[model samples]
Target: MAFLESVFAVIGDLTWGWALIPILVVLGIFITALTGFAQFRFFRRMFRVLWPGNQSGDPNAISAREALLVSVGGRVGGGNIAGVAVAITLGGPGAVFWMWAIALVGMATSLVECSLAQLFKRREPDGMFRGGPARSIIHGLGADYMWLAMLYAVCLIAAFAIGFNAFQGNTVAGAAQDSLGIDRIWTGAVLTVVAGFIVFGGIHRIAKAADIVVPVMAVAYLAMTVVVILLNITAVPEVLSSIVLNAFGLEEAVGGGMGAALAQGLRRGLFSNEAGLGSAPNVAATADVRHPISQGITQSLSVFIDTILICSCTAFVILLGGVYVPGAEAIDGVVLTQQSLAWHLGDWTQYFLTFILLLFAFSSIIYNYYLGENALSVLTESSVARNALRVIVMGIVFLGAVAPDATSVFFFSDPLMGVLALVNLIAIMMLLPTCLRILRDFRQQLAAGVARPVLNPEDFPDFDLDRTAWTGIDPDRR
Candidate 1:
């Protein structure tokens, strides 16, 4: 086990430390340039796509808003709170600037990837639409590369489905123990039972749960941060200035350097938003929308919400509360966040944070299950196999909650997610032209005064598409 952990750590260092991060930034920039900065150009349209009563009316399909909520549930996790605290602890205030920088480009990367997922999505026998890097690679890249698709599926299953759940469960257990005086064992047990009830119901249940929980949690968290910021309003300008300066190596505090700031920011930002990591595309494909770009744009907004809005809220709470000690070994992770909030809001806020952590971590676990289920669907069609996987996942969640150490779980999962991102980025790059074409078609229709853009696979006859899925013009319109 030690040897395996060492191997995974090394692989993770190389994949995330050296390769994937740079590639992700570059790809985000490339896509942003290619789409004429569509993330900004169509910024309003992104929200327009989320207008209420925008359902596709397809029983097997979720509304674009529900898909956004589901993706948001996955994106906004423990990372938003604990992860941001860790970054600021290790990378200083400047890290927040880089987090915003990555999200700016990541918005475009998400748009392209999610759009491609929609283009190549397959309608399952159960009537759900399913697609991701796996389906896109096989359908867009052809059968000759089916092995690559399978590889992506395996990696996603291991990373998101199993490994990530354990990590989240561990975080939740720690928060509960620290704040609520709860036992890890009990926390794990409750989490396992609650998660099983939802996961067993599959994607629709997950989506419905996310739609209700995500918005409320996000709003409440932001509201608390706003109060904290208002309390420290006088320091807001100084904090803002420090972030920008430190990002460029102007600050000389603990963990203050451009390199440290950039690394921590990008890493945590990517983990939070998951824009170019290809994880969101799995859920993005499940949305039923008239134009693939509509879902893509909707998912793009998720990145902004996750990192730019929610993560920033966490950053301000810590910075404004003034609990962060420069160069202190004691400050990191959930504890740092808890300490900051308690210092600002008093002792009772710890319990409040504990409850919030449960909501954030639990929602992430549900979202993670859906991603794993999508991957499992690629490898098998058997209901028994799927159910068995769910059981195994719940067991791991329990173990994660009770386990003393999470180092190995994170080491194992990080490299796998890095690999997943690498495969997805390569596949999406190959299929960029197709995504661009679809975007152009969608934009043209919108420009022609169509209230909602519609897609017709016949327009792109040369592309390899699941025609049956795109056979109808607009189910909502009809």
Candidate 2:
């Protein structure tokens, strides 16, 4: 076990620690500049188009707005809560600033990838439309990119469905044990059963479950965070100063220094919101919208909600509560946040947090399940294949829950996720021109007083899109 852990740790360091972070940050900055800062330009529009009523009337179709919530169901989970804690624990307060940086930068990266996903989306029998980085590669870049597309799908399944799902399972079972004194094995059993029911129910059921789950969990967790923030209002300046100072290695807060903080922030920030990792695009492409940019804008908002709001809230709660000591001994993500909240509010709050984290983790699992399904569909449309993978996912959750070492789980998952980011980022870079054109086209239509912009498939004679989804569109049937 130690040998395996060391091997994965070496792989993770090579991936997230050295290679991927600079590339991800630079790519996000380049995309952000390239789009003329679309995240800010469409910020207001994101809210305007997000009303629940904007959802589709067709039972088979997920609307742009609903897609945001469903994607949020995936985005906001253990990553936001435990991930932030882990960041602060390992990276220090300065890490929070870096997480913020990643979120701000990633918003634009998300816009490009998700819009590309919607643009190159293929119609699916199970859902209104299906698309992702793999779709973007296969359709946007031509047949020569087929090998890369297949690689993307395979990386997504291993990284997200298998690697990420295990982390979520580990978090849920661990939290349950800490808060409720539930045995980890028993917790794993109940969680796998519940998750199985939702996983087998397909996309619509997953979408509906996400709609109900995302908002409730966000409110519950944020409300708790606000209470702590209010209690420690006077400490805000000191906390903020510490974050900035530690971030630059001006002060010693934890771990190594600026380098440690930056790495954790980038890695966990990606884990929390998944800006450029190509995960959200899988679900984003499922939305049936008149314009691909509509879903793109909505998904960028998911990045903001996940990292900027939820992740920051978690960071502040720990930093302000006085429970997190500078240079503390090995910090456990689940325990640190739980203990900090309890320190601020009371012991009873621990149960509340555990419940909230469970919701976040469970919702994330279903979201991960769909990403897996989409990845498999991009490879093959076999029912037996999809079903077999679903069972494998359930079994992974069970094993992850009962697993003795949480650190080993993270060590194993980080490199896989890094591979995902590397592949997806490259694909989006190839399709950037198409994304920029779509953005410009949407802005022109908006400026010309079109209330809701519609995309014409023929607008770009260069690339072939699903003509059935664009013009001559059936709001329902493919």
Candidate 3:
């Protein structure tokens, strides 16, 4: 086990520290500049597109709003809570600043990939849509790029479905045991059963579940954090100062200095918000909007909700409650979050946090399953294979829950995800032309006084497209 950890750590460091970290940062800035920073420029329009004036009569159709919720559900998972705690534990308060920087850049990266996904989406047999980097790479980049698309789908399945889901299960199980004295096996069992119900149910069901759960959990958690902040309102300045000063190594503290902070922040922040990682594009592609860019805008807002809001809330709670010991051994996870919340509110709040983490974990699990399913749909539309994947997911969930500790789970997930995201980043770079064209088209429509921009297949005559999916989309209808 020790040797295995060492191996994964090596792989993780290479994929993230040396390669992906620089590529993601530089590409994010370049994409942001190329798109005229659509993420920030269209910031106001993001909210307008979030809640439709009215819902479409077809309940099964995935709306832009539902897609946004599903993306948010996936984004605001264990990564926001336990992952943030781990970041601070290993990278120190300085890590929080880097998290913010990554997120800011990530918002723009997300806008482009998700928009391309929407433009290149295909229709499912059930009349739903499915797309991501894989489909976009195949269709938008020409059939010659199909190999890259398939490779991406495979990596996405490994990272989101197995690697990351296992991490979520491990975090929840650990939290439950530490706070509520529940056994890991029991937590795994409960999670597996609840998750299976939604996983087997299909995409609309998952979206519905996300619609109900993500908003409530996010609001409740934020309100609680607000209370914690007010309680320690006087210390807020100090916490802020530490986040900035420690970020640059201006103050003497742990986190090993700025390099550790940047690596941890970039890697973990990518995990939490998933801006450039290409995961959210799967759900974004499913959105039933006339224009692809609407989904892009909606998804960018989710990055904000995940890192800027939810992840920040957790960091503030830990920093304010004074439970985090800077420059420690770097070995805490969700339990640290629970302890800090309990310190802020009371012992009972630990129970409350456990409950919240369950919501976070399950919603994310379902989201991860959908990504796997979407990726598999690209390889084979076999119901048999998908069902087999479901069983595999459940088994991995149980195994991760029963694992000795979070460190082992992190070893597998962190680096595996880095490799997975690297594939998508390459695809995003390849599809840059299509992405910029889609963005320019959307901006032109808005400038022409079109309140709701819709993509017409006729407009994109130069490119191959899935017409059935966009042929009859109403421009004025929600």
Candidate 4:
């Protein structure tokens, strides 16, 4: 395991460079600048459109709320908690600042990706909307990029479905075991069963489950964090100072140099929100939205919630609790957060994190499974093949539960994620002009009193938007 982990680590290092960060950062800056920081202007309207009871109707598409729920289901998971904890422990409290910065940029990255996915989304034979990298690659870059896009999807299934799923299973089982003395094997077995139930139900099931759980779990976890922060309000100033001081290479105040802080913040933020990773667009593509930009804005909101709200809240809990001592003993992700929580809330704190992790981990397994399904669907439409893949996913969930090595999981997953980012970012960069064009069109229609901004597929030059009888014409089908 260690040997394999080392090899994977080397691969990850080779694929992911410090240079890519600035490239993505610049891409994000460019998009926001070009769009006039649309995220800010659309945020309020986004909430109104995405919130429950306001979802527009479509023949074969999910409600806007359901789309947001599916997107959030994928975004808000164990990474928001444990991933943030790991960042603060290794990167210093100041890493939180960088994480926030990434999410702000990540929102733009997400909008671009989802916009492209929407622009190129396809209606599956099953009458469901299906689109993502595969559709986008074929539509924007042609069949030439098909192989590369499929290659990316395959890598993503392994990295997210197999590798990251293992980490989540282990985290949930381990936390439960440590907190309640439940046997890890039993925990794994139970989780495997629960995941199987959700997987067999497909995307709608997964979205519904996430809709019910994501908001509830997120609120519960945030409330706990709020309590912790308020109780330790006095330490808030020092923690914020530590974060700012560390962000700019101030080693004297932060204790560690800027590199550790920057890397920690960047890596954790990347893992948490998965901005450039190209995972959430799969979910975004599944939604039934009138305009791709509508879902894109909705998804952009999700990125903010994942990294900025949930992940950032976890960081504040740890840093404000004052449990993080830079360069201290070796501590695992959730364990460090657990210890920090316990410092403020006593024994009850452990249970709180344990429950949160279990919910988060379970949600992650479903999400990873959905991404795998979309990737497979992109290649073939075999039901048998789909079921077989589910079996494999379940097997991986069980295996990951029993695994003990952390580095291996991360190492194996990291390179694939970098590859995914490269492919999707390239696609997004290539499609930027179209994405901006769509945003402008949507904004114009809104200004013209088009209360519901549905566009005609025949009118759009890029791709079809209708999920049923698409025929590349809008009013003909509707």
The estimated TM-scores of all candidates read 0.96, 0.93, 0.93, 0.92
Which candidate comes out best when scored by lDDT?
A: 1
Worst 10 residues of 1 by lDDT: 469-478
* Residues 145-183, model 1: lDDT tens digits: 988888889989899888999988998898898777889
| Model 3 lDDT per residue over 246-318, tens place | 8888874663787777768877898788888889999999988878888888889999889989999999999
The C-alpha stretches of model 3 lying farther than 4 A from their native spots are 1-11, 52-57, 328-331, 403-413, 472-478
Candidate 2: lDDT over CA atoms?
0.85
Q: How close is candidate 4 to the true structure, as a TM-score?
A: 0.92
State the local distance difference test value for candidate 1: 0.88
- lDDT value for model 4: 0.78
Span of 10 residues, lowest total lDDT, candidate 3: 49-58
Write down the lDDT of every candidate, Cα atoms only: 0.88, 0.85, 0.85, 0.78
Question: Model 2 segments beyond 4 Å from truth?
Answer: 1-13, 405-412, 472-478
Clashes per candidate, residues 3 or more apart or on different chains: 0, 0, 0, 1
Candidate that beats the other on lDDT, 1 or 2, i.e. the better one: 1
Q: Write the per-residue lDDT of candidate 4 for residues 1-478, one digit (tens) a residue.
A: 7888777777677667654676677788888899889888888877776455556455445666776776776777777777787777677776888899888888888888887887788776676777887678887788777897888788878778777787778878888888999887888899999999999998878877887888888889989988888887888887788789888777533456677788778777876777767888888887776777888888888888888778877888777765677778758877778888888889788987788888888887898888888888877889998999888888777876766564254566877777778878888887788788888878887897676576556666554344352343244223
- Evaluated at residue 24, the lDDT of candidate 3 is 88
**Deviation of model 4 at 387, angstroms:** 0.1
Q: Give the candidate number with the greatest TM-score.
A: 1
| Pairs of residues clashing in candidate 1 | none
